[model samples]
Target: MLQELVLDVRKALESSRPQRQADSSFDRIKSSFACQFSSVNPRAFLPWGFVRHRTSKWIWTNEVTQPGGDAPIGARAFRKDFTPPLGKTPAQADIIMTVDNGLTLYVNGGQVGTGGDFRFAEHFCVALRPCLNVFAVTGLNAGVPLACLPPSKSHTPTAPPPLSFPTPLGAIPLRWTPAIAQGAYGVAPWGQITIPSTTPVLSLTAANWIWTSEVVNGNAPAGARYFRRTYYPPTGQTVTSATVIIVADDAYSLTVNGVPVGSGTDFHIAQTYTVNLAPAPYVVFAVVATNGGTVNNPAGLLVAVEIMSQCNCISGAYFISDGSWKFNTGTSVGFELPGFDDSKWPAAVIEGP
Candidate 1:
């Protein structure tokens, strides 16, 4: 019996060693990128009266009018080459051009675009490089006084507001502690873990893009219950109108405030799923899974989950200032019930009104 007990201890130690190694590797992978660029604005030129105007046909030696009677009609034309950052060329980019009254774009000094009756603001973009490169622009209009011009202005000039550019695009790292526990029944049921910080474990370096999280098993004991992590709607956010996304590995069952929302058997692999909840101050998110059930490996289950929100702004632009805006608008925390594993203990406690 003593020899048997020693064998069991050795086995437990051997199993725990791998878990510790996995946890360390997970930490290194998740901490790879330092979160920055939460304060850069890519649309800095918008408010500065920068706009793009396409033209039907190029008009040379044409007179141009000034906005708000700022300048008289004259033969004025200018051109410049915009080289994107080295080794950082985006597939597409927005162009902003401003003209007193009218403007036209030319590729290598050739008439290729045109615009007329300039007033408030005008902007547009054309495909770049690999498609068609080399470009120039010219302004054209009949010199007219702001007063002489009709009450309706085709173009309006405004000063650019304080600008903040977005961070460059790249992958972000994520890491978390796994749930574990010991009990008289041999092992306790595992509970899901949620990232504690209100902010995302990863930050967005670019706008209008997608990212993925890789799930890894960590410190799972034999007979340990299977578990997964999920995202809940931010706390303090109105539930009536809030949209939450939950993702997982293998299979997952989810609920919001105890209300059944979704369940799936195919998610054993890494995947992102979406959930919408009524706007509310706080929303509860939970997930349950089976160990050694569907996934090929039974050693222990490690799942990484990522939550993303889409914006309607142009490329490289987030409607909000930074990723933190979303977190600030909503509250986030983890919830758990008594289970088989001590590591399964809840990482967060939710306080209610």
Candidate 2:
């Protein structure tokens, strides 16, 4: 019969090899064919309903504008490599990325990250095995508005002049102890001092002030140096309104007693410089800082001088002679409260509501 049918097919393939090695529990089955058969590098296996078509077009806004406008999409000239091809390293593989609404993320080109505006619709992800990675993206709309698309034209309407604060304003009680040129407001020179402005004063000095510097043993002078101070507003006060701000985190330069009104090198944060004074009773506000001198470490300078009034109290209050009340001096700085009544204060409270 053909040698008994080859010995019954070799005993039925040895009884199916121990029932396929006792079913091997499907190797803890995590589907996708267990990462496409546990990838021994079959091109790192990626096929199980595979359908990837990642396309990035860039150049959105033929004109219908307003969805997140800032204008300027794709190729504003920025793409030094746009890398993304490394499997296993952000600790050991598994990466993700998403972008769709006015993106802005660069890696080799610099940036690093940024979100979208107006509603939502823009995603991001990071974690690419540690090295060998580059990404590029850029898109803007600038504040959209081109009249419902049609080629794209209309764009020329500058209007930003509505920030008035006029009154017979007066509020001074800014203190910072240590500078006593002669004691009781005479000699002065320890750090922080401001109290001498009273007249018809429209906006003389009550925006607050605090500055500190030290290096008395090494002969000072290491990097920053600029100062000024002059004030006289009393004769029917007339600064109308002025603003010179600073939160200083690094560099500085400002003047008034001798001119030069504004100068900043890298000083971060509260920055608002606007000065057009002619109705002077006595206006002099100067600030020269380099507290980060001896190689930068914890120097100081926190300044503010905003004045714009025409009456007495258009609802103002930021007290701290002990009563405690605050609205904004950066959270009443260590305890003198009395601010928080500028008509309920909350334009996002200052810049973001």
Candidate 3:
């Protein structure tokens, strides 16, 4: 019995390396954490769990309320997902199930057990992943006149940590945890961002056209260049709206917090664009400008931005494209993201206003 238990654990413990989980994947490494599993019983491990007798309802493709009902003699696939809370620790899930004809159980994409008898219920002690976990079942009926049964009886497991898996067998494309029901600040599922009936229009000024080098002093190599300027609201103040004028020597695309807004091509004409960072803590402006000229041709970018958190944007504070902006040649992965590090990139050079 002990040997069997060890084998089960070994099988459960065996899992492919976890894929990257989103939302907080690239968050600065503040610290690391892992679940300290108790030396005793079942927990979210991998592909292993214990099985016992527990009754559950059978799911029929054709409304087989009775075992003798005219449900087709074929296989039906059922899936549900459970997600644990986002925390440093792991969690355990105890499950109970029964099947009329035959059923195979897959957890988080791995087979756990199979049952052929509806008389003896199959109880499962499942360990959950830190992220989403899926429970998939395939049931088959051989046109038998027995009582119908599904896989597990829907029940919330006891928690040293926590368990909140909902069984929605018919729902495909399952996810382990509940969806992030909220959008950005002042967005839907939370509340609407209050836009004042009389919103003040902001303008751009006092910032020079800048790039890797000054036009008269140096020339930028052909191809593309990246530039970024980030703004933070004063402590306790939230940004309501913002505006900027962007211009480049050739062509450019601009994004605020990874959302693309507009672009400009002619350096002689700077396009005014509105930025809505309602209740903003901070915002980043990313620009990728391509100079279609040859290697020795000059390229430059000019931007002037005004952010309003207060009635008059903290008394007219403007961030412009200048030496404070970070710059890099060609393309760098994740450069558009707010958390991306540009500390190693050199500062942009001031060209002309």
Please give the distance, in angstroms, between residue 23's alpha carbon in candidate 2 and its true position after superposition: 97
Q: Specify the poorest-scoring 10-residue window by lDDT in model 2.
A: 1-10
How big is the positional error of residue 265 in model 2, measured in Å on the Cα after superposition? Answer: 20
Candidate 1 — which residues are off by over 4 angstroms? 1-250, 266-271, 293-353
C-alpha-based local distance difference test score of model 1: 0.26
> Candidates' lDDT values, in order?
0.26, 0.29, 0.52
Cand. 3 Cα-lDDT? 0.52
Q: Highest lDDT among the candidates is held by which one?
A: 3
| lDDT by residue (tens digit), candidate 1, 1-353 | 00000000000111111122225756634322221211222222212212212211112221123212233344233333333322222222333332335555443223433333232122223333311123333344355421111011121113221111111112111221111111111111111112112233422211111111112342222222322222232211122321233332334455545565566555334333344544443334444432334343422112222332222122110011111111111112333222212243333211110
Tens digits of per-residue lDDT for model 3 on 231-342?
7654334666677778888899999888888998787787988877756557888999887677667788877676665521122234567787988885798888788888
Models, CA RMSD each:
29.7, 29.7, 24.5
**TM-scores of all predicted structures:** 0.24, 0.20, 0.41
Error of 2 at 238 (Å): 9.8
